[model samples]
Target: MNKRIQILSFLFLGLSQIVFSQIKEEKLILDKKREPEVKKIEKKKTSVETIKNYPPEEKSANPVTYDITNVPAVSDFKTSTIQGQDISPNFNTDYQNNYVRFGMGNFGKILGDAHISTVLESKMEVGADVHYLSTTGLKKEYDWNSNQSNATIGAFLNNYGEKGKLNLEANYGLQDYNYYGIYALQPTSDTDLKQKTNRFTINGNYDFYSNEILNDVRLQTSFLSDHFSANENQGAITVNLSKHRLFAGNDFKMNTDLGVKLETLKTDFALLNQNKSSFFNAALLPEISFYKGESYLKIGANINFLNSRNESLILPQDKKSEIIWSPNVEVLFAPQDEFRFYAGVDGGLKLNSYAELLTENPFLVSDIELRPTNTKYHLYIGLKGDIDENLKYDFSAGYSKINDMQFFQANSIFDDVYTLNRSAYNFANTYSTIYDNGNLSEVKGSLQFFPLQNLDLSAELLFQKYQLDNLDEVFNKPLLQATLGAKYSMLNEKLNFGFKGIFVSDRTTNSFEISPNNISVPTAYVSTENRNKKVGGYADLNLSAEYKINKNFSIFALGNNLLNVNYQTFNGYKVIGAQITGGVKISF
Candidate 1:
């Protein structure tokens, strides 16, 4: 008819130009995720990866939930606030490997704890623990009515074999004290004026990831003893070995660390004090790293080998060997996602052990001496993120130069000859350990506030400047410090409440001559013993409450130094007032 209607109008304009154009057929996706046995099982080996492996929020800066209905309160268990924010307590309480607690207080204080653990299904785990603390009312005098006791026993082992992980630890401890800060004209009081200690520890570690460059090995050993009333004794032994090297991903990264440490110190007072101090330490750290996006850099060095001795200073220049170098750098800059900036230069070699300085002063002075404290320079800068996620912050600035730098003096101040030609110094009871050549400058700040969602608030501040060499005071060092804390949680999580406050400032000691007749002893004032003595300053308050009563039991109460402010953390020492502890914890 017109050539078959022009071929049906050219097949309807070729199906209307393929239905008006814009493609529309999809279905040919064949990407078995790069098949080939999944790229051969991701190339097998992985363990020496210098940088990568931190999925748990980069390994916990916080944020973990095991969600037991959002368990958070236990007075904010696992505490870490004051703005550092560690707060992790989603408590299923470690599946109750076992637990126990007991308590007593009011000067004759006593507390005890117990534990047990197990986990074997080839993930081998085992544990043990025991702890106790004691106190008997005191107020007669070396420094003011004192009695103390401490104990501990611990054991652990964890293994996750199949060519890797293994860890073990052991511990033992005991302590007892009573010196009574004399000088109402000596004489001696009770329990023959005591002080006793004993400790033991062992540690082991192994981490083999055989492929991809992994390695980690460690071992440690320790022993300690301290006995004194007069006929003093101080002892120590430590051994350490370490090795680490692992590198994996993040563009370029490398790591190597090697270590060895052996220490020994033994001293006996009287007979012109016997001596023995030996140290042989070695360390080498190598590092290089770079990370893209959000930036990060790490470059390192910290090589050292020291051999020091004193079998009583038979002089060979007093026997000491040295070779040290420090500079371990770090950097980080986070473009966004809340913020981050960090900078660092760190140096090491601390090890001033005698059970770590009697566990931070159990009223030292049993002819104690041990050395190996050298920071040799440190500089730091920091700023941490989080403005959302309920607020978080950290700020820091630091500078340090220490060579020995350890101080705690106030002993041998006055006795025979008022302590000698205007030298029998007199500050307070006792505590001795000095090694100064210090320099430190610091500034710190922190804050955290969680509007709600159970509430939490934290605060911290510190400012300091201390310098000493031929000493010009750096004694108890506290140039300003602060803390504020709070925690809350209710019903659902089963109750928890807490509060804390602390502040300190102005500290300088030559044993505080501070006289206005000692300002009625409310932290001391006055000043002058040729300079630097103004202990003063104090404020402290604390409280806590807990309930939990179900899922494994809990009940707690603690109230310490509740503004019964009578400070003196050394220097005629006298603190501990207004205290209460109530406890009950059971999970089996």
Candidate 2:
């Protein structure tokens, strides 16, 4: 009885499996039948009409009516209408018309490069840029617009060596600019129009390496010139030297660079307006590293110094100096092949000076009247780590403080009664002067993460605080921003599509003092009263593909802003609309 039962169980299991397979096949067939189909149809029609004629038609006679004498004549009415007309007047009127204008200008560049051979390489590039732009829609009355263009031609020659290499490059550039406009209201219009600029640049680089104490060294220099349209000329020269791995050791390395650049700017604004400026910057960097198993630590420091001077014939110019020093330390911990953690901190201090040209008389100022200085200090710390095969994360935070900030203050006197010392024949004009000694503080933080291989996301936040002696109250605010983007590959990885988005939020405040003796005077002081709020969002879809039609010919198409969403990213500026462009490329 047991054997018989086992046999029956096996038989039943086999039959059930066969039945399930057959049912699935039948369902699939039914699904295929339910799908729609396309077919052709033909139609035929037939019609019949019958007409019967009785006899030939005959024509009938006409009836007449008469009223000849009472109708008005057209000739009499034409003479009556033109009988009393006075069509002569001699008059003239003259009036002055004025207009305020505002406008915007834009320029862009599309560049391409191709490699030719092993011994020789060449690149072709084109670029256009606008110089100046003004918009008068904000003021509602005055408008201004300006623009300029530039073109570049470049070529290079490279040589390969056994242990080192050499490269020589030369570039020629041309700039064309024009300025023409009216300043203010006048009986007759006068034009302030001029055009200028030409430039030439050359560069050379040499790299040398050896298996000795010195690892590698590079030297470079360049020269530039500006030839203006009104016969104004200026020139500049720059020299740079860099050395790597001056000392070879298991834990320490040194890299240093010293550079000096000089520039001269001359202008013929008033038959002779020439100025020469010079700039010098130098830095020294050293890095030390210690490695043990999967844990490592590195420390680095950078010492920088800069100096600038300007000499002018018609304007007051002065010399300025700055110094900055930064030191950083980083540590990395890696226990596995796929996971790692790293953190670092960098801090620095900066000090700089600027010369303010002030005048007691309306138009007679030649020397530096006020010298304002500033000092700043900043600290930054961050941590970054990677996980799995496709996930990565980074976080950073920073803090900064600035002291002795400087700015120009404007004051106007309408008459001699308010002036301490005044001449009756002196014209009434505004006087402006610069003041220093303010304080500011800032804090910022950001985080970036990649959840997948094709997606990127980031968020940032910032806070700022400002204080000044002349203001009624201090200012403080916070700002937040975020961005997300993704890319996908299709059609055998030959075509790529992407999308991106950004968002930002911020707040600001301003304060004014009502009295000059407002030191700690609560009645004359005001608190923050300004509040601003805004929200904006935009989305873009892009598709790009490269199709190889043949060995020597190819085609490509790029469609940007596919949905044509008209939006504004700024207060007064609007985003560019949708555009579609395509081109074919040929190689020989």
Candidate 3:
């Protein structure tokens, strides 16, 4: 019986162990099935919190209450008196955009100028200008009529928008000049000695405000003609592109300029048989600049393609097509606001157009040639700074090597006629260009002093030295030049006075004599025994005063050549003497 009881106990213990194991497995399975729902609740809690609902209304065992009562307050401060201050009314000043001035003086002088500009529909700016100046003639005893007249009319339209700006302009000009200097040496008909020039121009420009590459574009065309059957026509187009980029751990600006120009000149010459010259040039300019707080460095080059059919009195007719390159580099450092330093080396090809030549010296011969000036290199260093709040100064020095520099030489018809009276032309009153390779050095300085709020004084000086490869002198080029000016206003700015003085140093020129037999050939002239001639320089002083009668009217007086020095600028040309003029100005 004991053995039977032991077996039964073992069986009972084994069965209990199996039952507990099954119960534990069932609990684990249930938890696993609910895991995803629990995780979802936890995720919702983390993503968005839910406020608990307030506990259901319940009666409180104890409650509290407070009583309200009114109380009076007393004031112990006294009121103080306030003082009033006087205020002045503000007035707006009306500005003038249109003005007309007319003046007359001795030597039968007449001057008239008019300008008007206004906004159209508050969107576009339109303006027009007209100017006329004339001088009847100099003293009759001077033996020649130095009459000159100039007139010009121009109109411009400007349109500005959020994206860009556009500008268009057209101009017409007329000029009449008398070759009075020629008459001083010989007698000639008024018709033969007079020159008239007509000029017309059209220009268009557009600027893109926010474009990354295309910044500005311009197109220009002009036509110029003279009474002697000399004509020049020019057309040009230019485009400027720039981009700002970051590279090599620094900010840099890349700029590119593309330009194309075409020019033609036609002049009738017996020897050359209606000489026609044409020039075509295209240029590519690229540069990179690095800028840092008031300092910068720029490195670039100008690449040019030049083609020309050129002929001149001295140079035989030749056709040329070539490519040229020039350096463009600059550095600037502004260590301080009051002091700055800069240095640069630059060069380029310059067009010597017929219009430019005629503007410089109106007595040029019809057989003149055209060429581009080659400036191989020009190195310069400069210093500019404000000495003080009221005074400023600048100084600079430069050196350059140039090729094909032009100079003017006077023409003579007869070699044997020591005295000009015997020859038909007496002194061929015409000039022609001569070119040479040369080196030039220059120094310049300027100063400005503002001693008073309404008064200004300024002065400038320049000095130059040239060494030519083949020419004896740099004809008609002044070695030294200076200018001084003073301006003052008083009596509530109603009265204004100004003074200006200009001084130029002496220059050197060459005289040439032609073989009478080959009068038609322009290249037949030879230098005189005295190759170099000295030309005396002169000083010109001018004074002006104006008294404003009211806001829209004013009376003014001008005095020119106050020293009355009869100075000759060219070989035979004498500038006008002293003169005075008084006029009234109207503003609206």
The TM-scores of all predictions, comma-separated, are 0.28, 0.46, 0.76
User: How does candidate 1 score on lDDT?
Assistant: 0.57
lDDT of 3 by residue, 36-131 (tens): 000100001011111122111111111323222111111111100000000001001122557677777887777676667777896887877777
Residue 440 accuracy (lDDT) in model 3: 92
Clash pairs, candidate 3, are none
Error (Å) of candidate 1 at residue 516 is 3.2
Which scores greater on lDDT, model 2 or model 3?
A: 3
TM-score of 2: 0.46
Q: What stretches of model 1 exceed 4 Å from their correct place?
A: 1-123, 137-145, 149-157, 168-206, 209-212, 217-284, 287-324, 327-358, 362-404, 409-435, 438-469, 472-509, 517-525, 530-588
Please report the TM-score between candidate 3 and the true structure: 0.76
Worst 10 residues of 1 by lDDT: 35-44
Candidate 1, 23-72: lDDT as tens digits: 13322232211111101000111111112232223222234432111111
How many pairs in model 3 have backbone atoms within 3 A of each other, for residues 3 or more apart or on separate chains, i.e. clashes? Answer: 0
lDDT of 2 by residue, 175-229 (tens): 3332211111111112222233344445555444232323334333333333222
Superposed Cα deviation of residue 420, candidate 3 (Å): 11
Candidates in order have lDDT scores of: 0.57, 0.34, 0.63
Among all windows of 10 consecutive residues in model 2, the one with the lowest summed lDDT is: 73-82
